[model samples]
Target: MRKIWLTGIAALAMASCTSKTSTPQPTASALAALPTTDWKSFRDTFIEDWFKVSPADAVYQGRHDFDGGLGDWSPAGLKRQGDFLRNAIAKAKTFDAAKLGKQDAFERDYLVTVAAGKLFWLEDADFPHRNPAWYVNAGLDPNVYIARKYADAPTRMRAMVSFLRKIPTAAAQIRANLKTPMPLSYVNFGVAAFNGFGDYYTGDAKKAFADVKSPALQEEFDKAAVAASKAMHDLGAWLEGQRGSATQDFALGADKFSRMIKETERVDVPLATLEAAGQADMKRNQLALVAACAQFAPGASVPACMAKMNANKPANNDPVAEARKQIPELRAFVLKSDVVTIPDQEQALVEESPPYNRQNSAYIDPPGPFEKGIPSVYYISPPDPSWSKVEQAGFIPGKSDLLFTSVHEVMPGHFLQFRHANASPSLFGRLFVGYAFAEGWAHYAEEMMWEAGLHAGDPETHIGQLSNALLRDCRYLSAIGLHAHGMTQEQSRKMFVEQCYQDEGNAKQQSARGTYDPAYLNYTMGKLMIRKLRTDWTATHGGRAGWKAFHDQFLSFGGPPIPLVRKAMLGGDGKAVF
Candidate 1:
């Protein structure tokens, strides 16, 4: 749902500045007159340095000064980024956490945590050379300029032209950086993403800017877009040519897998322990699904019960319209139930997914914290046209299922969370949200809404919520299985279908996704952590009366790793995450 590639590295920005001053030593009195360490100033300086290295991220955060800019993904540029992170990690560790104020110390720890995660991907994982999704997801998406109205048409058009003009070079750098003999799944994803970008750049992207009536600027745009499209097409073609040689060596293996979870999410549970947790959740959900089906589908098998639930598709086969109608209902329920605070009246617009970014079925593109008066967009991807009719039909979510999707992507989920995050006093917290924190909260919202009596006791509605939970549980296991235990792609796919009750099209898509995104396990992992935190905190705070207080306090941290938030809330390390 979020920019998976850049989130880790974006905030980890300082390349340690060394000095060569040879002045005389200060007297004790002069030393006493000097100011103490200012954590805020140091943190701000690091963020400013980060903007230069990851300008695309800055642009997303509504820093228009960086509009149309891209990160340097070339070999030297990547090395520079890695150096910056390593130095940032080293620099952050120099500060004595005990000396800093409570909030400052927390922020410092958050910075170190983020930098470590980034270093793992940039250096240890070697994602730039190994995974095409790294490039695809590394804040290269141009949807912001088109979707958000942060500027006049002419101004945004100029930014688009400048951005498009740089794509050819970026595309070449991406192609050169990616080493071949990639996993077949990665290669195919790369092919689809690049070619899809080519399609959008020439088609929808150009049209989005057509309203800009400057002939000179229009000419400039045409030239730039054409070049960008060609570069994208060429890159896609190159990846396609490597299809014959594609390997299945995508697994991170057990040790790296364990380290990945630890470094990225701050979760250090053993693989066996984590897998058992996931398996237990799946079984629990399966049992709940059966109980719901007994009332909803009578004697049908589990698959048949799910089939019956899915058959209640959106009217006229249009999910966008159905989603639009559900927004107010979901929003009202969140308020009525007092599950969480909706910080503002700002509503999310619903639309179909653009060609270039159909990786996830649904995702919310919220405006950055610095931007004002711009609405967030919730995008839903249609089935791939190449799929069979039945598969396409299966891809369309049922009305009940769509309700939870709305809950997850908007309403009291991501959009509401962002509203609180945007108000964060910390710039780093406002601008950068970790994957586990963001997705975990959203996934947790689905069940939270159900527990708060959304469509209370209705079998169909309960099925929708449980189905979503089952999907995440499968992801939790599949991620550990695929990356740590050498589970085959086919095995992962079967688990999605049989265990999660996902449709054929979704099962295949989800399994292939595990190859490039082993961290997709964060959804369920995050949810479990959050649930535990809520239970632990509310038990002492005010029992059920503290639900709203818990929700508000939880979202106020913006999006750090869950373990960090857990520690903050529980007043200790809160060692067990799952």
Candidate 2:
């Protein structure tokens, strides 16, 4: 909800560039239409409809046909889209499973899940009306055109211009549709986002197309982009005006929150059980931190040891440079340890995140699934220099903490895990990877790598990894607390500081993120599910040796919810998910 970016997708292309392999070729079976197969026809139309509603999704997915198209965000349009999903679900269920292949059936499950998530947000949760983010942020991927190279500069510029020209219309619909007295958090996020739209539309869009030699296209882009920015500025100012009336009633309530977990992720674990798991993980991390503190500093207080860790910040607080320097060493560590295969020599490019996209301090925008070979941009939003010294300092992470982030964002984390997903043989596996699996695996990688001798069991490194774990655990608690149990923002902020040991600045930011991103509990929730899967799965697959195999196999299913993937991976066993 606060649009916090949790996972960094390392463009595995850079990671995979050394292989000298060309773009993924559509197989004969994949390209040619088998009109007779219920699955193929259904899959084709399903993908078409997805692009039909969210053309930005097409741009991200590398489908250029819909690149310039925009969604109709009016109320009736949303219902039309919802109806399509409902009908699609019923149609998918009507197919006789006995006639479908193993993968086809699994794809059906993925299809249902995808449709359900869309319907839930539109119909159940009422995201379109209640949330400013739903409308103001539509088709607003800052790097969609900048990051991907699906086509030459001129052609892509034309597409971007086409899309930018539609922004005014989108803004008009949003102005008409969005309810006033929007959630305070949503309004604040919208104001910041739209204010940043000026820089993104005017400057970044131009830079992205700077190499374009087409004069006429450039002129069109200039005209379109200018108008788009004006629309955004007006919309943003309008939201600011409404901020006075914006209430803090943002929670999805108990019922919708539960359904969000159950339907979207296919997890039905009760809130109490989830809270217990989060608390257990937080305590475990705290105890580990205590032990690590003792080893790192035998007689120092917790605050003192943390000060030492914080002191390890980069020279002049240049995190971008530090992250760049660590890339090679992290890659080498993974290779030497057999933690997982690197598969290529391409590197993740680290940089300061764009202003509009800095809703979270750090995130990765990897090339979409259809992308062949492009750099995945991992972004860390260092604090604004204008902020107070204390605020700026909170944004600069310690050296060991930075390393764990590198692991989470790149090296054997989101980037590496996605490498396995990118190689999936099925379209469903390639496109439908679930958020829980993606973020969960990245979060889990931090501890898993440490256990595998990363940093040779250094206490500082353990503190960094455990600290991240504790942060995610607090996210789990804060999400359920905020949405289900009526936890106040002040209470959640205190929870972050007291339970997770977050600094005041970070505690404040993370607490607000929970107001909108209730599903963030997925970090710990998904990890626990994966851990359970590993314990049961590895016992029979052969204990230690089974890990690499598990990591590789787990990623191979694309990004499906673990439950769906689990059902297939474990011979239809679903008990482990519950």
Q: Against the unseen true structure, what C-alpha lDDT does each candidate score?
A: 0.83, 0.74
Q: What's the lDDT for residue 435 in model 2?
A: 69
TM-score of each: 0.94, 0.91
Top model by lDDT, which number? 1
Which pairs clash in the backbone of model 1?
none
Write the residue-wise lDDT of candidate 2 on 128-159 in tens digits. Answer: 77776565345666466666666667767777
Q: Once superposed on the true structure, which residue ranges of model 2 sit more than 4 Å away at CA?
A: 1-37, 136-138, 576-578
Error of 2 at 50 (Å): 1.2
lDDT tens digits, residue span 238-350, model 1: 99999999999999999999999888878888788888888888999999999999999999998999999999999999999999999999998988988788887899999
**Which residue pairs show backbone clashes in model 2?**
1-516, 1-517, 14-346, 433-559, 433-560, 434-559
